[model samples]
Target: MPEIRFRPKYISFDCYGTLIHFQMREAVEPFLIGRLSPDELDRFIAVFRTYRFDEILEYAPYDQVLESSYRRTCRRFGLDAEAAAIEAITTAVLNWGPHPDVPGPLAKMAEHFPLVILSNSDDRHLAASVPRLGAPFHAVFSAEQAGAYKPRLQAFEYMFNALDAAPEDFLHISSHQRYDIIPAYDLGIRNKVYLDRGYDPELPPYEYFSARTLADVNTALGI
Candidate 1:
């Protein structure tokens, strides 16, 4: 385990994969069932995940991201893509519950340091998810408000400006390196925690603390 000291005004999180399971794969599994074999479905899911990441990097709206990623993944899999399927996946994201370990540790940590969420979700969508976190947030920001998505420097700047804090004032925590850590590091956020959920292989060159669960995060903070 990596040793880390938590000393920040706010501990910011990437909500989807870090705090919540981010059921994108689960949401689409039923639709893909019987349409493709298990092995084929795995490949399709992988491609869809990559396409979704690529779409967000272009600074498009989240809805376009879901639609294009669905179409591209369908093309890759030789399946027909429909707009309703994309809409269903997007709706599923908003309906996702927090990870089983999230609510308790998050509530405990909130008592020590203010908690903040920087999610790639719209205001209306996040309205449903944030309360399920079971902790009062100091702030919750989204790509819809920022006009850009994660891995973009502009999104981080929006959060920093909104909170009136410097990069050093936050201990940024996230599960995805490409989506969160690399950009955050480049933007001068040094105290970062990689909440490793196996979204991608760990790249130690980023020099971030790693935790397997939110309980691990609380322990790392000495709480």
Candidate 2:
């Protein structure tokens, strides 16, 4: 067991990338086939990612956010955005399962503390994703309920209000610095874990620990 700053009331998480196998690239790649040259594919996907981030800045259904972003990105490259393509992306999200390293460590932690998720997901999509995670969660919150997404203070505020717990009561984990940890830090959640999945850069000033996987987090928590 390694030293940790605090023992939390709940082990909270940003589900999609931290635990769930987020396969956005895999899901959207087929749609771009022949529409973009091989070199253009990466650039287009990057733009799509940016639009996705932008879409989540304000309140909207996750499906609508996806649709808006997808359409905008497609239009930027002169490709026709189809309704079926939007549906395909939203449907693909439900099929994502946990990362291979998640379940055992999560189960171990669940013995000592309740597990919670504050995901940028629709309620129905969250329902589909949670059961596939193999470990039980004490609570799962969605953007649909909160009217906001990760990195937005409103989302965290809604989650905090719903859990009836203050920022100090939980240890939040995420792979995304911008989308989860950074906002969490700004909101005064000091006990956080940077699940270093390489999706984002690590900023030490935030004062959170780093873990390669949930297993590392389990060890850090002295489980």
Candidate 3:
């Protein structure tokens, strides 16, 4: 069990991969459709994922990141690089809904504390996804609004300024170490929860509270 400490004014989250199914690979898989061998397709998918993260680090718009990742991945795989392929992947991201466990615990948590989303998504994309979480968010801060993406201190700074809340005032929860926990820790956020969804390995030195699922998160909070 993870140790829980410090009740927060708000519980901030990373919506996409943390709460939502974020079916980027599932969306891209059909597009491959025998263009590449199974092993090659998997390798392409991995490359696309890496490129997406790398793209975000460059401070470009989210759509550009998605498009460039698709183009680059296709080029690497010797596949036909087309605009439609990128569009399909971007569309899939906007249309994704929360994971099965997300709505219940998120809604329950919202009843007790304010819930906020700090996602590396644009406003247009997040608009479709946030409602699917089945919870009333106190605020949804996006990368477009921040003029930067996550893992950047500026994004969190924008969130804190918008909410008029300090770093110590909220419990930040996310599944991505690069995007959420590492940066949150650097910003002096003491109440951090690592929702381990297997995207990254745990680094104990970050000193975050860990939960296997949203249910574990709720239990840790004594909800």
Candidate 4:
């Protein structure tokens, strides 16, 4: 892990998984349990994850993205794609809680820095999810507002434009390296935190420090 070298103008976060619970697996498992056996279930899950990643390459309504991802993933695994199942999983996003360790430390971090969220969610959905983080945010930006989604450069460009801030001005944090870290780094944001929520493995030359949890930010940043 590297040290947090500069005090940033803003501390930006990716809401899902990094701060919010991001229980996509929990929300979708009901649709697959009886359909696949223990062996097939594992491959089904991997494919689903892959499909979800594929779904974000273009801008679309978040609900449509979820439905299309699920439908494509299901078809790949030789399963029926039910619209109601997709609806259930999409709706479940609103009720996810914070990671158990999130609230207290994040609230403390907010005291020392201006907090912001750059989420790949719809406006109405983020309204319900953001409050669950238990800290007041300086700004909460959504894909619905930005008209783009992450792993795509336009998404961050939209966010940068909205915050009226440049890449180097903030310390961006996220659990998904593919979604946030690579894009942020390419855009000239050097100060970054890779929160380890186990979505992807870390690699060097990625140009960011690592933290196991939100509480570690205090010590890592010398706050």
Candidate 5:
């Protein structure tokens, strides 16, 4: 848990899955229908997620990463990857809104600390999703601007450079430890909050406070 009186100069967030409802699974589900049984489908989705993370290890356009990962997963299952479906998935991603619990507490936090976003998606997708969070951001950084993604040091490095701030100066909030907390911790961001969306386990070694909603994060920050 965070220190009782702790407050950061800036509160940074991992946009997708943490704030915005990540609907990648929903977007990809239609394409996989009829191709595999229920059990196989679950395994396929898990592998597809791994492939997407692997594809982002090197800098590339987000759409290209999605396309290549989707193709790889389809081919592994002996199914064809449809070009049109990739476009459809990208469109679906751009249209995703915040999770149900986001707006109120996030808005409250915005009133106290300057809020920022460090997201994996590009500027265009963020342009659509950020507004739906019902709070104004101090700044927003995207993988496209950084030329890198989370779990990679370059992405967080870009944010630090852009803000002209050190990691200790900020409090980071994210749901996925693998994508956000782990990398942020490595970069020396000590004040962290893991909003438990259940994508990953709460890792105590990383030294982050765990909460199930933004409301809990708001309370932790004393906002």
Candidate 6:
């Protein structure tokens, strides 16, 4: 076993990009078909992600966030946004499985620590995704439960309150700087792990251990 540096009271995670294969760009690309060049589609995906993040600044359903962001992206690119496309996007999320690296190592961690999830997702969608993770979670929290999304202090606050725990009691792991890691650090969660999924930049000021995969995190924890 590796040296155990920290043993948290609970191990919390950001579900989407960290554990689950967040395939937003993959899911939306087909909709862009002939409307955008390859380079423009990449920009379109980035802008759509921005809109989704912006939409969640305040309380709203994840569906609304997706719909509004998708429409805004299409409108920005002068393309037509259709209801079917919105429906397809939402459906795709329901069917997404965990990243190939998640299950085995997550299960190993779960053996020694209570695992939890604080996701920027709806209960229905989260429900569909959790069982696919191949591990038992102590608690699974969603934006629907918190009435807020990641990067928002309210979401983290809600998780802290629900667990009746303080920020110091948990090890929060995530791939997103703006969405999960930064807010967590600001909220005084000293122990954080950045699962570098390549979607966001790494900022060392936050003082987090970086891992390329869940197995790396498990090894770091001495599991």
- Cα lDDT of model 6 by residue, 62-166, tens digit: 888899999999999999998889999988999999999999998898999999999999999889999999999999999999988888899999999999999
lDDT of 2 by residue, 65-149 (tens): 9889999999899999987788889889989898999888888888889999999989998888888888888999999888889
Judge candidate 5 at residue 133 and give its lDDT.
97
> Which pairs clash in the backbone of model 2?
none
List where candidate 2 sits over 4 angstroms from the true fold.
Answer: none
Clashes of 2: 0
State the lDDT of candidate 1 residue by residue for 1-223, as single tens digits: 5556658998999988888778888888888889999999999989998998888876766777888999999998889996667778878877889989899999999999989999887787679889998999999999999988998899999999999999999999999999899999899899999988889899888879888898987887788
Give candidate 4's error at residue 20 in angstroms: 0.6
On the 0 to 100 scale, the lDDT of residue 38 in model 6 is: 92
lDDT by candidate, in order shown: 0.88, 0.89, 0.89, 0.87, 0.90, 0.92
lDDT of 5 at 212: 88
- Candidate order by lDDT, decreasing, is 6, 5, 3, 2, 1, 4
lDDT (Cα) of model 4: 0.87
Q: lDDT for model 6, please.
A: 0.92
RMSD of each: 1.3, 1.4, 1.3, 1.2, 1.1, 1.4
Give model 1's clash tally: 0
For model 3, residues 62-101, the per-residue Cα lDDT tens digits are 8888998888888888888776777887788877888888
lDDT of 5 by residue, 43-133 (tens): 8899999999999999888888999999999888888888888899878988889999999999998999999999998999898889999
Per-residue lDDT tens digits of candidate 4, residues 63-137? 888888888888888889887788898899889889998999989999999999999889988899888888999
Off by more than 4 A, model 1:
none
lDDT of 3 at 15: 84
Against the true structure, candidate 6 reaches a TM-score of 0.97
Clash numbers, per candidate: 0, 0, 0, 0, 0, 0
CA displacement after TM-score superposition, residue 120 of candidate 4 (Å): 1.0
